[model samples]
Target: MIESAFPIVEVPDMEAALRFYRDALGATVVYRFPPDGEPLFATLQAGSAQLGLGLAEGATAGEGAGMLLWFYVDDVDATTRALSDAGYLVLEEPSDSEWGERVALVSDPFGTRVRLGQPIAPQPDEE
Candidate 1:
């Protein structure tokens, strides 16, 4: 089951990107990584929609169209499994991410890669 979806845009410079989106489009910073100092990722709210910006290499001329469609699912592994069974190309197996989400990558029918992610559930307490 999918909960929500968003696009993660690749950017070369976080500060410059923030300035562009915030000044030109009036996008406000909603969330950012590394509580202090530099951030590797940031989420901005432009009107009613939220957009994610992540630092990526090879982004030139301040234009980045390398966007990844991210889906928040109920179960990352199960979702990837179903997609794989249905003949979709599973690019990466489901794995835990450092940011507290289980994630997987798969290529859509049109060859565009999409990411599936879900919050990691708390572990059961041992007796």
Candidate 2:
């Protein structure tokens, strides 16, 4: 059984990526390497979700990844609209799914898929 996990994105530009996650997503820098100097690695916290940003050596952000990062939000529609309005690429518009979720997908400048989802209550069963 998995205990806990956090997604890490390797970025070519640390400062820019930091701003994107921080300002756009409202993540706060919880930890950083070399606390006093240039940040090569850092951890960001937005509610319960934590994202790690590390300086990319050879691999770029979201390069050759088979998994998509999902973020659970309180309001999928509002969050999707806000992110899209801020110039992020919207891969999927907010829509209701058969699985009882309202979901939307957007990509960062580096092509990282950020999926926002809000759970919807199930309908009553037929008699």
Which number leads on lDDT? 2
Where does model 1 exceed 4 Å of error? 1-65, 123-127
Q: Candidate 2 residues 57-113, lDDT tens each?
A: 665545456657777888988888888888888899999887778999888778777
How many residue pairs clash in model 1? 0
Reference-based lDDT, residue 115, model 2: 82
Q: How many backbone clashes does candidate 2 have?
A: 0
Residue 31: error of model 1 in Å? 31
Question: TM-score of the candidate numbered 2?
Answer: 0.82
Pairs clashing in candidate 2? none
TM-score on alpha carbons, each prediction? 0.46, 0.82
lDDT of 1 by residue, 15-96 (tens): 7666545543356899999769998999988657788888877554311336455667678888788777767778899998
